[model samples]
Target: MAAGSRRVRAARRRQRRLAKGTHDLTEVQWTALLSAWAGCAYCGAEDPSLQRDCVLPISRGGRYTLDNVVPACRSCNASKCNFEVTGWLRRKQLDEQDFLLRYAEIRATLVTDLDDLDDPRN
Candidate 1:
C-alpha cells in the first residue's frame, strides 16, 4: 500500500474511534497534554480555560492523535474554524511572545498545582 493510503486508513480508523466517544485519556493525561501545548496551536492564547482543539478538520480527515491536537482558547478556536495552523497564524499575524508566556505559565501552573490535584473539591 502507498504511504498516503496507509495514513488515510489510520485517520479513518481514528475518526471512527472518536465517534464512539470512548476516549482513553484520564484527567491526569489531559492535564499533561494541555500543559504541554500551553494554548491553541493556531493563533496563541494564554487563557486558563483553554479547550481541546483539533489540528486537522475531523469532518475532512483528522485524527485524535497527540501530534494533531492542542489546547485552544475560545476566540482562537472559533476564528480558526476548520483552517490549518499556518493559515490561521498568517491571517492573525500571531506573535511569539504570547506562545512563550503561555508555555512558561503552563509549566508553572502544573508544578505549583500538583498538590491541589489531591483535593476533592478540585
Candidate 2:
C-alpha cells in the first residue's frame, strides 16, 4: 500500500480504539481537569479552555486509558494533534523529562496493575 494510504488506515484504527475507550470518561476527565490545579499541560496557561487529551496520541499507538490521557487547553491539545508526546513537548519548548515525570504521576494515580506502573513507552 502507499504510505499515505497506510497512514490513513492506521489513523482509522486508532480512532476506533480511542472511541471505544473514551465513550464514558466525562466524569473522570473532568476530575482530571480539576486536578490539574493550574492550566494547560503543554503551555501552562491558567484557565485556558481545557479538554481531555491523549499524551501518547492514539495515532502513535497509545491507549485511551486515564493514565494515557491528560487535561490540556484546547489550543495545546489542537496543536499536539496526533504527534508523539515527547516530540510535541520538545516542539513546545517544554522539558521532556519534566513532562515524563508528570505523566508518570498521572499514570500512578489510575494504575491498578503493578505492571502498568513501569511503561517505558510513556
How would you encode candidate 1's per-residue C-alpha lDDT over 76-102 as one tens digit per residue? 888877786666676788854565466
Question: How many clashes in each structure?
Answer: 0, 0
TM agreement with the true structure for every prediction: 0.53, 0.64
Tell me the spans in candidate 2 whose CA falls farther than 4 Å from its real position.
1-26, 110-122
Worst ten-residue run, lDDT, model 2? 109-118
RMSD of each: 8.6, 8.0
For residues 3-94, what per-residue lDDT tens digits would candidate 2 score against the true structure?
99999998898778777655444564556544753567676777656777877776666665666667788888888998888888888898
What's the C-alpha lDDT at position 98 in model 1? 63
Total clashing pairs in model 2: 0
